[model samples]
Target: MSTILIIEQVLNGLQSGVMLFLMAAGLTLIFGVMGLINLAHGSLYMVGAFAAAAVAGVTGSFVLALIAALAAAALAGAVIEVAVIRRLYDSDHLDQVLATFALILIFSEGTRWVFGSFPLFLDIPDALSGPVTLPGGIQYPLYRLALIGVGLLVAFGLWLLIERTRIGIQIRAGENDREMIAALGVDISKLYTLVFALGAALAGLAGALVGAIQSVQVGMGEPVLILAFVVIVIGGIGSIKGAFIGALLVGLTDTLVGIFLPEVLKLFMDAAPATSAGSSIASMSIYILMSLVLIWRPSGLFGARA
Candidate 1:
C-alpha cells in the first residue's frame, strides 16, 4: 500500500482502538469493582445511541445529543443497579450472567418498541464534516480525528479519576477488598452505583460518537460489546492500562490485516479467491490474537496472579 493509504489506515485503527477502549474501560471497571458479569452492558450502549439519535434528530445539536446520551445511559445504569443488579451481587456468576442476559432482551425489545425497527441517523457537525491535511500531506476526516482526541482525553481523565482523586482511592480499595472498605465506613452500595453509572456514561459517550458514523440501530452494540469483552480479556480484567494497550493492539491488527492480507494473498493465488480468503482471515485475526494471548498469559497480559 502507498504511504498515504497506510497512514490513513493507521488513523482508522487508532480511532477504532479508542472507541473500543471507551467500551472496555467501563467494562473492566464494572467487573473489577462490582464483581458482576454484566451481559446487558451492550444494551446500555444501544440505549445511548438511541438517545443521541432521538435528541439529535429533534434539536439538531450534536452536543445536546451527547448530553442526552450520557444522561439516559447513566440513569438507566443507576436504575438497573438499584432494581435488578443489586439483587444479583451475592449470587454466583452464572446467575449474574443469566440476569443480565434477560436484561439485554428487555432493553432490546423496549428500544424497538419505542424507536421501531428502523435505524436512526446522526449527522456530523459542520465544523467537523470536512477533511484536513496532515503533516505528510495526507488528508483525513476531521470528525474521526476529533474522535481520537476525545478518546485520548477521556482516557486521561479516567486515569486521573481512578488514580488521583479521593473517590479513585475508594474505588481502588473496593477492587482490592470490598468488605474491608465497607467496614471502614465506605458506602459500598453507593460506590457501586457510581461505578456503574460512570461505566454507563462512558458507554453512552462511545455510542453517541460512533453513531455519527455508523447507523444507530437496535443490536448495534452486540458486536462492539463482543470486541470489548475480547479487549478486556486480552488486556487483563480490571486493568485500565491493559485495556488501552489491548484495544490498540486489536484495532491495529484488525485494520492492517484487512488492508494488506488481500494484497498478500493475491501474490499467491487467483484474485477472486485471494480476496475472499484474505477477508476471511482478516476477520479471524483478532480472535487468533486473543487465543495466542490466552495461551501465553492465561490470566491476561496484566491480570494479578491468583
Candidate 2:
C-alpha cells in the first residue's frame, strides 16, 4: 500500500479512536465514581442520536440538533439515575447488571415505538459536507476531522474538570471514599446524578456527531458500546488518560489490520483465502490486544495497581 493510503488509514483510525474516547470517557467516569454497571449507557447514546435527528428534521439547524442531543440524553440519564440507578448503588453486581440490562430493553423498545422502527438520518451541515485537502494532498472528510477536534476538546475540558476543579476533588474523593465525602457535606446523591448526566451528555454528543456519518437507528449504540467497553478495559476502569490511549490503540489496530492484513497475507497465500483469513483476524484484533494488555497489566494500563 502507498504511504498516502497508510496516512489516510491512520487518520481514519484516529477519527474512530477519538469517537470511542467520547463514549469510553463517560463510561469510565460513571463506573469509576458511582460503582454502577450501566448496560443502558449505550441506549443513552441512541437517545441522543434520535433527539438530534428529530430536532434537525424540524429546525434544519445542526447546532440546535446537537444541543437537543446533549440536553435530551443528560435529562434521560439524570432521570434514570434518580428513578432507578440510585436504588442499585448498594446492590450486588448481579443486581446492578440485571437492572441496567432491563433499562436497555426499555430504552430500545421505547425508541422503536416512538420512531416507528424507522432509521433517521442527520445531514452533515453545509460547512462540513465536503473533503478538505491536507498538506500532503490527502483529502479527508471535513465532518470527520471536526469530530476529532471536538473529541479532543472535550477530553481536554474533562481533564481540566477532573484535575483542576472543586467537583474534581469531590469526584476523586468519592471514588476512593464516598462516605468520607458525604460526611464532609457533599451531597453524594446530587454528585452522582451530575456525573451520570455528564457521562450521558458525552455519549449523546458522540452519537449526534456520528449520526451524520451513519444511519441513526435503534440498537445502533450496542456495537459501539462493546468497543467502548473494550477501550475502558484496556485503558483502565476509571482512568481518563487510559481510556484515550486505549481507544487510539484499538482504533488503529482495528482500522490498519482490516485494511493491510489481507495485502500482507496475499504475499504468502491465494488472494481469496488471504482476504478471508485477514478479515477474521482483523475482527479479533481488538480482543487480542485487550488480552495482551491484561496479560501485561491485569488492572489495565492506567488502572491503579490492585
Candidate 3:
C-alpha cells in the first residue's frame, strides 16, 4: 500500500512535469531564437487565465473560453513583439530584462484594473471532471490526465514544427548565427514575431489548464515563470528534448519530496519536527536539484558546451 502511495505521488510529479514542459518549450525557443529573456512571459500566462475565465463567465462554455484564451494570448504576443519588444532586440540583456520587467507591471496593473482584485474561477468541463482508475488501482483525476495527454501532443507537434518545417530551418539557422541568417535574406522580423506568439500560446494554454485547478488571479504567472526558468536551465536552453526531460524530473522530484520527506523524517524524529523539516526541504528540492546539476555540468544536462 505504501509503495502504491509512492507511485501515485510519482505520477503526480510526472503530471506537473508535463505542464512545466509546456511552458518551458516556448520560453526556451524564444531565448534560443531571439536571445531575449522575457520576464513578462508569465504575464502572458496570466493573460490566458484571465481570458479563459472572462470568456467562460460570459459564454458559459469552457471550450470556447479555451479557444479565446489561446487566440488572445497569441494576438497580445504579436502586438507586444511589434510595439515594445522589437525595440530591445539589438540591445543588451539588461535592457531586455528592464523592458520586460516594465511589461509585468503594465500587465498586472492593467489586469487588476479590468478584473478587480478578486480572483476569477474556471471550471473543468463536466465530461472531464471525474476520476479514472489505472492499473494497480491507481486513481487519478480525468482532467489532470487529459492535461498530460494534451501536453504530450503539443510537445510532439512543436517537435515537428521545429525540426521539419521551412520556418523551422530559419529558426534553427537564426539560433546558430542571427546576423549570418539575416545576411542570407531571411525575414528575421517576422520569425521573431512567430516565435514570440508561439511561446505566448504555450504559456496561455498552461495557464488555462492550470486555472481549472487554481484560482485565476493577477501575478499568478510569476511563481510558475521562475520555475520554468529553472526547468530550462536544468534541462539545457535551446534543447526541446532537454526541456521535456527536465520538466518531468522537476515535477517528479517536487511531488515525491512533498509526500515522502515527512515520512522519512518521522523515522528519525518527532512528527512536528518531521513535518516542518519535510515541508521546508520539499519546497526546496527543485532548486537543490538545479544546484547539483550546475555543480556537475555547469551548462546543464543537455546544454551545449559553452
Candidate 4:
C-alpha cells in the first residue's frame, strides 16, 4: 500500500481502538468492582444508539441526541441493577450469565416493539462531516478525528477519576476488598449503582458516536461487545491501562491485516488466491493473537497472576 493509504488505515485503527477502549474500560470496571459477569452490557449499548437516533430524528441536534443516549443508557442500567442485577452478586457466574442473557432478549424485544424492526440513522454533525488534511498530506474524516479526540479525553478523564479522586479511592478499595469497604461504612450499594451507571454511560457514548458511521439496528452491539470482551481479557481484566493497550493492539492488527495482507500474499501466489487467503488469515488474526498472548501470560499482560 502507498504511504497515504497506510497512514489513513493507521488513523482508522486508532479510531477503532479508542472506541473499543470506551467499551472495554466500562466492562472491566463493572466486572472488577461488582464481580458480576453481565451479558446485558451490550443491551445498554444498543439502547444508547436507539436513544440517540430517536432524539436526533425529532430534535435535529446531535448534542441533544448524545445527551439522550447517555441518559437513557444510564437510566436503563441503574434500573436493571436495582431490579435484577443486584440479586446476582452472590450468585455463580452461570446464574449471572443466564439472567443477563434473559435481559438481552427483553431489551431486544422491547426496543423492537417501541421503535419497530427498521434500522435508525444518525447523521454526523455538520462541523465534522467533511475530511481534513493531516500530517504528510493524509486526508481523514473530520468526524473520525473528533472521535479520536473524544476517546483520548475520556481516557484521560477516567485516569483522573481512578487515580486522583475520593470516589476513585472507594472504587479501588471496593475492587480489592468489598466487604472491608462495606464494613468501613462506604455505602457499598450506592457505590455499586454509581459505578454501573457510569459504565453504562460510557457504553452509550460509544454507541452514539459509532452510530453515525455504521447502521443503527437491533443487535448491533453483539459484535462490538464480543470484541470488547476480548480486549479486556487481553489487557487484563479490570485494568484500564491494559484495556487501552490491548484495544490499540487489536485494532491495529485487525485493520492492517484486513487491508494489507492480500498485498503481502500476492508476492507468493496468484492475485485472486492471494486475496482470498489474505482475507481468511486476517479473519483469524485477533484470535490467534489472543491465543499467543495467553500462552505468554495467561493472566494477561497486566493482570495479577491467578
The Cα RMSD of model 4 versus the native structure comes to: 0.9
Provide TM-scores for the models.
0.98, 0.99, 0.97, 0.98
lDDT of prediction 2: 0.94
Q: What does candidate 2's lDDT look like per residue over 59-140, in tens digits?
A: 9999999999999999999999999999999998899999999999999999999998889979999999999999899999
Per-residue lDDT tens digits for candidate 3, residues 1-306, read 276787777778878999999889889988888889999999999999999999999998999988988998898899999999999989999999999999999999999999999999899999899889989898889998898899899999988998999988998888899999899998899999999999999999899989988989999999999999999999888878889989999999989888888989999999999999999999999999999998988888898745
Off by over 4 Å in 3: none
> Which TM-score value belongs to model 2?
0.99
Off by over 4 Å in 1: none
**What TM-score does model 4 achieve against the real structure?**
0.98
Instruction: Evaluate all candidate structures by whole-model CA lDDT and list the values in order.
Output: 0.93, 0.94, 0.91, 0.92
Candidate 1: deviation at residue 76, Å? 0.5
Point to the candidate with the largest TM-score.
Answer: 2
Write down the lDDT that model 3 would get.
0.91
Of candidates 4 and 2, the better by lDDT: 2
lDDT of 1 by residue, 170-277 (tens): 999999999999999999999999999999999989999998999899998899999999999999999888899999999899899999999999999999999999
Candidate 4 residue 133 C-alpha distance from true site, Å: 1.5
Candidate 4 residue-wise lDDT at 264: 92
TM-score of 1: 0.98
Identify the runs in model 4 with alpha carbons over 4 angstroms from their true place: none
lDDT of 1: 0.93
